[model samples]
Target: MNAMRLRALLLASLLALGAFAQAPARGGALPPPLPLFPLDNWWNADITHAPVDPNSAAFITYLGAGRGMHPDFGGDSGDPSAPIYGMPYVIVASSQPLVPVTFDYDDESDYAAPGRTPGYPIPNEAKSQQRWIEGGLAGGDADADGDRHMLIVDRDLRILYELYALHWTGSRWEAGSGAIFPLDSNARRPDGWTSADAAGLAILPGLIRYDEVYGPDPIRHAFRVTVRHTNGYVFPASHRAGNTSGALPMGARLRLKASVDLSRFPEPMRKIFQAMKTYGLLVADNGTDLYVTGTYDTRWDNDVLNPAFGAIKGSDFEVVQLGWQPSRSDNRRRSVRH
Candidate 1:
């Protein structure tokens, strides 16, 4: 073929290929949806878009008449200028990536708590089958904070594994709690039960990723935060009494009050705050008041992220309408996904 004609034909083919590569699904529809849980899980199922809990007003009133809200996330990690700067994030990378691991545990471990195993060179997975070889144990304590939550996602396998207080004693992986979760479900921890996290909730479900801020997708779920006090439990929350108290019970879901103003914040911060307003936060553990959870990424600039929510306060949040589901039977999920 003539050189000019050949060049023109090649250019036309390339243009067509580029458009096809970026095209939407058939009928111009969006891609298939991701599940609501696990590492790949975004906030698509977040309560913000869900119907308002009919009992939100009463729950807020019960928490207190004059209670103020706080932002657990913001400012910089270890920077004085940041409001919630003291908290750190744990970044996963150590050990074998995307592989399950076996560990030795104390009497408190879920495997031991159930009381099924006897002496063994390796503990059995009859009860804890999912724990052995889940995620890579090589995670860093980003904020230098002791929470040491480890999250590993096997993207190829479409699975997410989580652990709390995870540590490698140079021999075996030990942790305060551990859980195996399928990335494809809206499932909560079984009612009146617990997972690797104290709140019986999966840790990855609530954490904010840096990409979520930079990407088109909105964070679709609630943020997991801690508080020193809570009354009882709530629904979507499967467990109760992570050691119980006059304070809140395990699985309590609290949302950012809708009335709060988010207009002044920047785009990224506004997205997060808007999520708080709509989806609110879940009480996953006992800690300082209103500390929300997020992952570690070096790309974050403390200067920008910290000041984004500077004007927000904790009292601005209100308890949303969610009641505790006390029994496994009461909150039994027939399948992983509803």
Candidate 2:
């Protein structure tokens, strides 16, 4: 072939390689940010106009109105081996092997359920990958008291598996409780059933993912939040983790008051606060008051994240009415996108 023809062929080959490199990973690699569940799902609901609970003031007081909003995720501490300050998740393909998971709360867990594939789609790497669980304990440290949450997404099957207090035995996997969620549907856990989260809610939907936080689009869903105390759970939250009178319940939604100004914050931080105004926060567990959960990512700068979130206090939020739902007409209007 002529030299000119050979050059053209080489360029074509390079172009093809570039396209392949840009393509998404084939073995269940994460796709670009999309709606986790349906748009009408509670997590994605537009609750800006939702009714404020009559007990909003009392609940906020119980949760310490003066307490600041805390970002419970970000860059590492000095120790490289210590688990990062956020929950971690993994994605797997449909062909990923499913393993039987023994659960302490077997009745509530979905193990061997009809719709679910016989076992959890937990990857083998979870046994060796330190980042698979909350505490960053890989195959060792089976007795840690931390929540040890393990969240796995089956990208091809559109399924979510979440395990609370997960531990790996030399021969098998065990957990305190396990829950499976269908990502494409908005189904709640059976009434009074606890999932991987205390609220019986899907943890992935409410978490602030790294990609979503730094992406071009705004975060369009509610965030998973924690409080020092909770009284029974309300609608959308399937289980009640506590009964502290006058305290907020699991599944309670807190909207950032519109009056809270974002002008002084940087653009990225502003998008986060803006999401609070729109989708609000859902109380999912018992922990420090006003702490929000996010995925583990080293790219996070806690120095910037900490102060920015700390500026807002619990008083800046209002609790929505218990079991609030958009009107039929409103749902129809907002149902256009996921």
Candidate 3:
């Protein structure tokens, strides 16, 4: 390689090492600036910037923030009806075994423009959910169409799998759409490519998780939020708003208040609260205001986190990067061509 390239790599290596050495001992550690899917691809490269439009004031006026951040995943597995709002995710460790699984897709499939044939192998097993599926009917959003979601995180593969309109036929997995994303890569669906998610975005990357909370790592990217209405969308968003009466759009981004103090919470919970200030949250789907989605794990103590969220309300959030660019603003085909 050229001398300049080699020098840049060396400099980056030193900086990373320096940051590692300086990690604070008392509180949760800071996450690396760039996150990769498995080991090399950048996952959250686009979300780290501050909001472009600074429309938090307008958003607060229209779509209220509702309540402080709440933990959707946690606690003993006994509670049948908890983690209210929308769908949750499933986490699988790298060491866990991969099983013979299948994926079924329809109109929403990113694999196909008109949507390709279904019945692709996903390699999942029953043990996969200890988190299980969120049984019962799916919510009535046009995008979700009563199809409950199945979002999986394979920590070992560092790969993320998302399936929509999912239903288990007693023996295997069945869903409307499916997309696999490598956590290491910065790649997104081709401009307007739709994934299993309503926004055509990968679900796992935008979720809240127990490990990211309790461990030294902070959530690097924004968490996916559901809202009742929207005005338009922003770049990196592959779909248009299903409804336009609201103030915010499909891809509108929201950042947590930098002034919101996190020092009072426990170390684990502190990382999540701090993420709100740093990574912020993204508007992904339709649901209750400020409801951030996450994976299902018994370790999460929703009761413990419910009260801590009282500190901040919807007014504390800012709408970063408003969905402008005349072509993308209107509800036409979600592409630059208009």
Candidate 4:
């Protein structure tokens, strides 16, 4: 073949390969038509009309009602090599290999007998790919710190595996804690058990995935949130990581007041705020109050997110009655896109 034609063909092949690598279905973040769990699950419950906690005022005050909401996620830090801030998750097939993870809190983690074998399904590529695990680093990087949460979903098995403070010991995986959940069920962890999250809740369900925020459908589930302090845990939350007096519980729900005006914000931000009004935010962990978590994606522009989220203050939200669940007859939603 002519030299020019050979070069052109090579370029075309590279472009096609890039496109395939980026396809959502191949191994992207969560795919569309979501609510990872069943609609009736607490993550998908419609709490817009749920009664507010009588201590809502106190809770709001404790969380600093004057503070504006913060989007705890965004794109790269100018440098393409930097990891974005947010909890990231991966979708794997049933064939994804199950690797044994040694847990710091072994009693609370899921594992096989004898040697406490690693049974969590993780993609092999996570060994070297950033953004596969939380903190956006490859699983084997020992230098990576922070929560370092790792969430993996076996789509074919409809199961979720989440690890907290996850790290690779060069020889094996070690974590602070880990939990597995059947996506199709509403099962809760054993009482007082701490999962990958302090609340013993599924992290993916509560994350504000990029696709769901920008997709055609409205967000249908509660977003995960963090608070500076928590007193205990409520129903949906099976574990307690804090005991600060007068603070909100781990499972506390904070709903954006219907009175909050979302019209002034851009469409995407407005939709997020609207979901806050509808499903509310689930306090899944202890961190900065009103900091909402989402997926790590380069598409996210912090410049747009920062000021937009800052517009809504803590005062605009009210704490829903703790442990409140919608009526069984209330079939009001679908799966969480995360």
C-alpha lDDT values of all predictions: 0.50, 0.83, 0.56, 0.83
TM-score of 2: 0.89
Candidate numbers sorted by lDDT from highest down: 2, 4, 3, 1
Candidate 1 per-residue lDDT over residues 1-338, each given as its tens digit: 99999999999999999765532211111122332453223233344433445655554454554544444443334553222322232222112222233443343234321222321112222122221222211332222335555554433333445665654444455566656554566555666665656666777657665667766766555677877665555655555544443455656666666787788877888888877875567777777665666644445665666555445555465554455222333223212332
* Candidate 4: count of backbone clashes, pairs at least 3 residues apart or interchain: 8
Per-residue alpha-carbon lDDT of candidate 2 for residues 1-338, written as tens digits (9 for 90 to 100) = 99999999999999999765533231222543367887778998889899999999988888888888999987568797877688777776667778999999999998853465579877677787677778777844655668999888777777888899887888889899998887778788888899999999999888777777777878888999999888998888999989988888899999999999999998889999999999999999999999999877778888889999999998999999988876666567664442
TM-score-best of 3 and 4: 4
Candidate 3 root-mean-square deviation in Å: 12.9
TM-score per model over all chains: 0.61, 0.89, 0.66, 0.88
Show where candidate 4 strays beyond 4 Å.
1-33, 112-118, 332-338
Q: What is the C-alpha RMSD of each candidate to the true structure, in Å?
A: 11.0, 4.5, 12.9, 4.9
Worst lDDT window (10 residues) for model 1? 23-32
Among all windows of 10 consecutive residues in model 4, the one with the lowest summed lDDT is 23-32
Model 2: ten consecutive residues of lowest lDDT: 23-32
Candidate 2 off by > 4 Å:
1-29, 112-116, 335-338
Cα deviation at 321, candidate 3, in Å, is 2.1
Winner on lDDT (2 vs 3): 2
